[model samples]
Target: MRSKPLLRVRKTGALMVAAVIAFVCAVPLAGAMWQLTPVLLIPVVVFVWAWRAGTDVYADELRVRALVGSTRVPWQRVSELAPDAGGQISALLDNGNVIRLTGVTSDNLPRVLAAGGQQIGHSDQPPS
Candidate 1:
């Protein structure tokens, strides 16, 4: 059990802001046009995806949460964290499968590593 709340790593905060803007814009259109009410679904989905997608670092394990589901990997199971071609960070698991950390990127990898209780070296990036 962790004494502190889980540490989180997320994509740009811009996503959530966009979701809010979309919802605000849709509200008036939906109320006036009536037919635009169904359009509200778009912002709702965006809000869920933007707000829910991220990785949460717990004491014993790390959870990669997505819009629809989540996957938890124990610290011992992670062999390394590397970036994909798209520059998104991924975890190379001991079992040989790679788990793409949704909100993790090279720039934020160090923070994520620290939150996971992994020590960072002098290098700008984690070990390849």
Candidate 2:
């Protein structure tokens, strides 16, 4: 059995609103012609992706989920959590692979770390 997640970082609810708006607008276009019916799938896919994509932080591991799949990284395998220029967080693994965290951001990185029971310490600071 899986334990409850300590933290779940997901896209803002605004994406759901956008998906609804897009679907509403696409309905008229889809109704106008049979060839355009596939257009309806766009908003549906977006809605599902927004609803499902996120990062789940557990005490012993991290689960990063996308629209189609999820990757699990044990805490022991994580070498570092890094932020990119765009402020998105990524995890560097001991195997030298980087996994971009779906919904984790620089601003909330500390919270994610805390949820995993990681203590924050500055490398520049001298040890007592």
Estimate TM-scores for all models: 0.79, 0.92
- Candidate 1 regions exceeding 4 Å error are 1-6, 120-128
Clashing pairs in 1: none
lDDT tens digits by residue: candidate 2, 24-113: 999999999999999999999999999999999999999999999999999999988888999999988999999999999989999999
Model 1 scores worst on lDDT over the 10 consecutive residues at 2-11
* Per-prediction CA RMSD (Å): 3.9, 2.7
Model 2 lDDT-worst window of ten = 119-128
Clashes in each model (backbone N, CA, C under 3 Å)? 0, 0
In the range 1-128, model 1's lDDT, one tens digit per residue, is 74553688777778888988999998998999888799999988888898889988876788999989999899889988889888898899998999999888888888777777887546678789
Model 2: per-residue Cα lDDT at residue 78: 90
TM-score of 2: 0.92
